[model samples]
Target: MRIQNAFRLALVGTLGVGAGLLILSAVASLSTILTYVGVALFLALGLEPAISGLERRGLPRWAAILLVVLGVAALVAALLLTVIPIIVEQVGELIALIPVIIAQLNRVDWIEWLQEQFPLLKIDEISEQAAAALTDFFTNPDKLSELLGGVWQVALAIGSGVFAVIVVAVLTVYFTASLDAMKRATYQLVPASRRARFADLTEQITQSVGRYVIGQVSLAAVNGVLSFAFLSIIQAPFPAVLAFVAFLFSLVPLVGTLTGSIIIVLACLIPGVGSPLTALVAAIYYLVYMQIEAYVLAPRIMSRAVRVPGALVVVAALAGGALLGILGALVAIPTAAAILLIIKQVVIPRQNER
Candidate 1:
């Protein structure tokens, strides 16, 4: 009887492990779908504040949502219509100038200086070899075919991206429309005694997320506008395209602005587009701008949005980026804030009681 009981226990343990593995496998398989759903939900929460604001001003909920959505759609359409073609043209120009840029690099003062410093290093030889390799790659049929295959892959990826955008957009609208209902349903799952508290915390969390999204976007817009103005003034290459790039990168947390600034400065150094003095001036502007952004703009804008500590923000952004790339980074700060709120309201109190 003892042996039979032990055997039964082992069988159950094995089954439990198997079930757990199967569940994990299922989750892994559904990861992409899950990511889309998560992004949609995040965006819905972000739009909630605007919808609520409109609702407060005597608009019906449906009308408020419709207006906000239409406004956003219009803005997106306008940007695409005006900016995309210019960006594409600028990109083509950049690609066409690559050989000229490479040839110019061989004559750069820095290359000569580096060669002077390192007597054994043959900078010209390396540059020539690189140029030759590039020329050979372009001329070779097999290499050209490989390049064509890569282009096909890029085309497929773009198609997939468009499908993803559509999916996320539709999901966002659905989630936004039913968000209140969803919340109520969620509250119902909690015990009556705890439901009110849960609902309150949920509201707070969602509001924080919404405000953060708005604040972040506002910052990005500021950066984009300033970047465009500055780049134009400096006669930098593709001002509009570079500004758009800045705006997109600024949407990410922590390292976004710095990365954008670096890219812009590098672009300023590109042969035919900008000179070394132009790049230096652009770099200086960005350095000062970053300081202003850090000390002034971010604090003022983000103060009401989320009250995360600087250290925690860095850690959360890094961890989130590692886990889910940009989306993870975007959500990480709010997730941390939500966790902190729960810990303060629930965990600490429980500990005190104990």
Candidate 2:
């Protein structure tokens, strides 16, 4: 009888393991879809504060959601129409200017000195290879055919991306509209005695996330505007393109501003159009701006939304970027805040009670 019971237990354990593996495989297969849904949920949460604000000012929930969605769509359309052409033109100009830049580099004293100092380091050969690679990639018929051969694959990828974006946008609209009802439903899962506590904790977490999103957007905007103004002042080519890139990069936490600044400086140093002096000035301006952002802007803007420690912010951003790229990094801070809140409110109190 004992042997029979042991055999039955082993059979059940094996079946459980098999089922778990099957579930895991299914989840892995649908990982991309899951990622899109998660991104949509995050965006919906981020948009909640704005929706709530509009509602407070007498707009119906649906009306406010529509207005916000329309405004965002218009802004995206405007950016695409205006910025894309300028970036394409600048990229073409840069490619054409590359040979000229190489010729000028050969004439520079630093290049001669460096080559002399490191005899094994063939700067000219390296540059030639790089130039040839770029030229071939662009003008070679073989490369062009190869690129064209993959056009179908590219199109399919693009279609998938578009479908994902549409799914996310639709989901975000729905989530924003029904967020309150969803919260109520979520609270219903808790026992009657614990519902109030759960509600309070959930509200704090959601509020923190909303505030972080709004504050991050505001900071990115400020960085982009400042970068645009500084680049224009320095007579940098493709200021508009650089500004748009800056805005996107500045959305990441911790190292985002520095990364955007480096890109701007590099843009200012483009072969024929950019000068070292312009690059230096742009770098200096960014350094000063970063200081101001750190000392003044961040404290004021981010203080109300979420209070993450500086060290933890860096770790979270790095880990998130490593795990899931930019989206991960963007959500990391709020996630860290939520975790911290949980530890503070639940973990600590439970430990004390014990």
Candidate 3:
């Protein structure tokens, strides 16, 4: 019987792989569809509490949903309004300073000192070629003109991204409004005698995910704000932009914080802000903040939530990021959490039953 089961499993796996490959080759695609659905489901689950709270205050379900979504939209618009102009101005300033940075770097004592030891090393050769090419192009340009053409393509990309955002928002609103109906339909798939048990477990899982996601978001926001404040105090260029990037990247699990810090530090070098001393200070800040998040904030906010182990978190983050870049990394934590939940719910329960 066990051998028969193994053969059946192998056959199912082989067929599933073949179908997946065929879909990858032939279908328009299910990737974006699935991702959008997942995002809508997550947004609905997150907003469920707010919906309940407003309902308790005697608001109609539709009215409560609309009010919450509108509030969220307004807050998001306000944040973009405040943050966008600062980032644009900072970015322009940084780009304008690039030539000055290169010039200053060429005159640095270290470069001259290094050249003395390595006389054959033509330090300025590559820069001179780039400068000559740029001057030639600008004085009488072609490729430079082509570069300007690319700006229009960027605008189109932005438009597409905005469209995607709108679609996601619409889906989220629909999902949130029909959450109870969706749950009912989902539970309908289970046997009648098991529906209550399934519902209870589903509620537990949703609550767990909600708590974990909310806590992680709060921690990321705090980290961003603190980082921006620290960078501003140290007179780092593009502090707000870097902090915003950090916040966005923070949705990815363990490695994101470190990746963001590295990017910020590299960008800091562009505008003459990141000195050795400042770099050391930044390192210390990261260490302190990471310690606090891991030991203090995370424990307080997410302890009763995920219960995913430290080692597993590290492994999942690394493996996921390696395979799927940022999306993989972001999905890894929840995937690991769900697996842990399933092990407890199924394996341990059955073991104890026996």
Backbone N/Cα/C clashes per model: 0, 0, 0
Q: Give the C-alpha miss distance for residue 156 in model 2, angstroms.
A: 5.2
List candidate 1 segments past 4 Å from native.
Answer: 92-117, 121-148
Q: Please, what is the whole-model Cα lDDT of each candidate in the order they appear?
A: 0.94, 0.88, 0.80
Task: List the RMSD of every prediction in angstroms.
Answer: 2.9, 3.9, 5.2
User: Could you tell which candidate, 1 or 3, scores higher by lDDT?
Assistant: 1
lDDT of 3: 0.80
**Which ranges in model 2 have alpha carbons more than 4 Å from their true place?**
78-117, 121-163
Per-model TM against the reference: 0.89, 0.84, 0.80
Q: 1-354, model 3: which lDDT tens digit per residue?
A: 699999999999999999999987664466666767777777677777777789999999999998988988898899899999999998898788788888878776765676788889885675578789888877766777777889889999999888878888999989988988888899999999989988987877777666666777777888889888999898777789988988886766787787787877766665364576776677778778878887898788778767888999889878878876665676677678888887888789999999
Extract clashing residue pairs from model 3. none
Model with the higher TM-score, candidate 1 or 3: 1
lDDT of 2 by residue, 256-326 (tens): 88998898898788767888899999888989999999989998999998888999998999999898887
State which candidate has the highest lDDT. Answer: 1
